[model samples]
Target: MDPLHDLTSHDLRVRHAMEYEYRRGTNPSVAAININQAYPKAVSERTCQRWWKRWQEEGVDVEDKERPGFQSKVDNEELRDLIEMNPRFSSEEIGEILGVDSSTIRRHLKAIGKKYVSSVWVPHDLTPQQKAKRVNTCKDLLSLQDSDPFIRWMVTGDEKLIYYVNDSKKSEWRSPGQRPVGRPRPDFRQQKVMLSVWWDKSGIIHWELLEVGATISAEVYCQQLTRLREKLKENRKSLVNHWGVNFHQDNAPSHTAKMTQNLLKDFGWKIIPHPPYSPDIAPSDYYLFRSMQHFLDGKKFKNREEVEVAVKEFFGLKEKNWFAEGIEKLPNKWREVIELDGDYIIN
Candidate 1:
């Protein structure tokens, strides 16, 4: 019997007690004495007498009480499935999928000795370097790991590709049973423009617009450097030499190609490259695209030009600091990301 569920255990014991009492009531004194042989563990005559009187007073529920604690949010089987699915999913993500809170997730995980993973959703457009930069930057920024003393700085940027879907800001997939029938699903594939920018804490941005559906060539890459050169000037004049401003970029062919180096030399720029295969680090990989995607949900455009205009409008509305705030998460997360360096973080 479950010791924690008083009603079930009490009902069982009392039913047995009633049968014993009824048998004793019908038997001769010799048999009655024999029935007295039925006793609780270590119970003598006096203890049995006390127990019998207590049962008489309380009815069949001799040991009835409330259930001991909260019911478990996740059971062993589900926990095992989640651990199998992704050993890295945090308490929060597991809880989200299970419709429980993170504490419950942690409780189950701890009980099973399972580690937690993050549940962050990522868009498909980020490059590997963008991914790493975002994770490491956020980690360092959160942990306040400013090894450079008072004049704190960090660079964050992502190459943005605009599609018709990019205008529809936010869209959610309905549950299987809730999907509409008869009509075909909307088509999302199409040609669109790509734009990229290199930005820093001081609010300067060097941006480029690219023609979509074509491989970016050395000439196009050189054009982007031309834009960067103009943007980096103090009064649209000379370039800063040896003045360290960390340049962040995704691993797009244009960003890493030899063409990029020739231009960087001509107009000096400090570049810090992030590791490949991690998107959780790119600020725009998370921030700009999210904001833009939310804006694009359910909207339709006549053409790619219309889509590009919509994107500019969407980004234009966002105040500059909206992007600036991404840098604030530094310092606190320094140790966590550094310790697990090059790994994806989903916070």
Candidate 2:
């Protein structure tokens, strides 16, 4: 390649040398050899000098090498959809499916808005009905928010169990310079015992330590309601004065028990209309208890006592606003679920 192709400051010196030699009228062979190390015969001294001056004026980087090869593996759109499908997949796994290197996957992902967020279970494919339900639920929740807003009189609560087995596998470092090891433990929910957690904007005022887990009995659920009433009474001087005490629970058989229904009617606790088989509508399902489960992951407690403490600590640390935020979402969601004719997804 002719050195003049670059037209750098150094090339200017060569050009000037060639010109001086040309003017001196040296042997054509010697002149050609001298120029051969720098420029071609077709390159005039003036042109070389101009290019050299341009290079000196504007210090530019070497142009990058040509792109090396064809793209391997998945297309950008396909990779994006797959990432959207499941955020938990690492680049290596994505590459394997797409038939490309992990680096290719990483490049594609970075191009989109996806960041290396904590692994998320990007939900499984939902049916058309499922997607519609979810969207409608949001609409209802928003409507509910607009109607009542907040008065502190209306408090919502739900009961759930925090299991003993650490239901989550976590990455830990045993030594330096080694890749962190993740405990790949499947979700081991100990259905034998469950904690009944019910809290409002105030805090976790009532909870039940359930001995039976598989299917909650009507009597057991009624007992939970009874305890919940008693606990709420303890918080306030008179249940009568707090007239807005709305007992919100799902259609667990016990909640719909003949005796329990009578008791709620007698107590004058407003029963928020709860839809059947609707775990999505519950705040505990969406916001509050997810944190509790996450904390319980990768932890082990042999006895009920240790499990109780962990459960207590988990709820105790949550901010008051977090609970309120969940409750606040309910009214609008309820209105929406009702409007969708009972077919809205609540997440």
Candidate 3:
């Protein structure tokens, strides 16, 4: 071998110096120190010991031998094209196509910034027209808000299923080697009741816990609206007399039915336009129900009355500002919908 000083490759110099040190019966630690002094971080003592052991057991070679395996070569362009064509393809699937090991495929995919993530489920695969409508509606709402600032007077309502049992898997503190606590799988047939609730910036105005298995129809929804109006008269008399009611509800079949519309007109409430498949912008869906779920977590109710008590407790715990904050998010959500070109707001 050429003199270590004459070796052009830094790796070759390190190997050659290790070999020289082995020939001279120098210890690996000393050999590593000498090599690092010469080349600065050329190799660690452990690496020198490994090379010395290899040379003593097998042989010495200044250059690295080809690693013994089927060398996997991935064509990055081909891999990228395959992923672009079908992002859902698994590492094993791509490996089969590329004639490489799945592990190799995973490493390469990671190198190219590919990550396996579950697809986010959207409310709808909106058509271009639907997207345009969402954008236009949001813009109009923003305009209405700027002119009227009527969100404070707006009353929003929606129905949610209140499960009798709301247990969920949760993490627990345990000894390191101990197995995690297990939870039973969720029961799809668990008893639940429909909770129809209406609220404004002030707080909940009206709420009802329907009987088990009762679903809202157009007639039922219209009756609920009448009840909601009566509640508003009792609780929010000032809002009804001064600002009137700016009602907001999703475009459910019952909510959009002719009877429902006629009832709203008779009550003289201004119906705020809510685009279809837009729970992201709805105060009840995004804010109120989300907080209620947190409150209901791990709770169990034996009867409808127990569930009703829990619901009332949840509502009563929230202050007036909390309800106001929920309604306050509407204009910003509307702006976001327009800014995102009608894409659902992730947060």
Candidate 4:
């Protein structure tokens, strides 16, 4: 027959020629080279070797065969479009739309660089003005740190809800073929207490566990500040008398209330500017509370007294350097916030 011109005919002709060469004991490399010299598009030596191995093991049939339940070609563009439209679509859902098996869809999705992950939780959806304010505030703080290193004189504090029972699920070592150990589901409405804590570069300055059914009003917050001032006089007298205190706290209703502001002015402490909805930049949120949460995990507390003891123990175990390390991270965090254009520092 005249040498085939169209692609399919040419492909079959080349395969038949390869079979002929194989039967005649021609080497795969030599056959591939010879075929390329005679054909339009070249086939690789690896392809020739693969066909030879298949012929020896499974018996050769050059004609394309339909797989049992798999498709030979998937419209990758359509698949990409579907994923771009709604990334939450599962493999099965994509498969249904693409008329393929879920396994096939999964393989294709991976090939196209798609991944499924849980969304990161942020404190708030920041508007453009909020993001700009975060960036500008961080810049101003960085400039202030450059002029005078006031981090050592800074006193930062925040309040957190401490649960009576903290349940954490952790991984464990197990024998091969053994199922993982299961843990009971956590209760959503477990009893909890409010813990207000203050710290500086040195260590814990003051802390309190509030009574049940009590909240920190502006008056109450001022009382706490007053107590904190006395604690500073006792624990950090030099900071109070000489270097002075740079107070840091969130803009909660109580902390920013008129009475609270007046009290802070009366004490003559400089208040650090904290951007709204920016827990990521707060030392207590990103550092102190993060470590405290880890310590509290898997622990069971009977009452406010037990929780208070645990909180004290947690602070007692931490070294002075550890507290300083957290305080020192402030500058780097400010730079990072600026670098990210006010995005929350997830790390």
Pick the TM-score winner. Answer: 3
lDDT agreement of model 3 with the native: 0.76
Q: Return the lDDT, model 2, position 67.
A: 28
lDDT of 4 by residue, 1-347 (tens): 11111333556677888888788888988988887787744466777897888789877777544435657567889887775444434565566456575556655766775544221112334678888999999999999999998887999998876777677645443211123465543332346677899999999999998896466789999999999999999999899999999999987778899999999999999999999767778899888887988899899877778988899899989999999999999999999989989876765
- Candidate 3, 179-205: lDDT as tens digits: 346554233234778899999998999
TM-score of 2: 0.51
- lDDT-based ranking: 3, 4, 2, 1
Off by over 4 Å in 2: 1-151, 169-192, 212-215, 238-240, 332-343
Instruction: State each model's C-alpha RMSD to the native.
Output: 17.5, 18.4, 15.2, 15.9
Scored against the true structure, residue 132 in model 1 reaches a CA lDDT of 63
Candidate 3 error regions (>4 Å): 1-124, 169-182
Q: How many residue pairs in model 1 have overlapping backbones? A: 38
Poorest stretch of ten by lDDT in candidate 3: 1-10
| Candidate 1 lDDT, 1-347, residue by residue in tens | 11212333343453455446534553323333443455322123343454455556765343323223534457769867765533434454456466665456555655664432222222223445654665666555444445553213455666654544323212332211121233222332244456666655444366656655543566776786676756666522322444454556655556667878677666555665444434444556555565666677666666767866776687678676766665444333344555654344544
For residue 10, model 2's alpha carbon misses the true position, in angstroms, by 56
Please report the TM-score between candidate 4 and the true structure.
Answer: 0.62
Which residue window of length 10 is worst by lDDT in model 4?
A: 115-124
lDDT scores in order: 0.50, 0.56, 0.76, 0.76
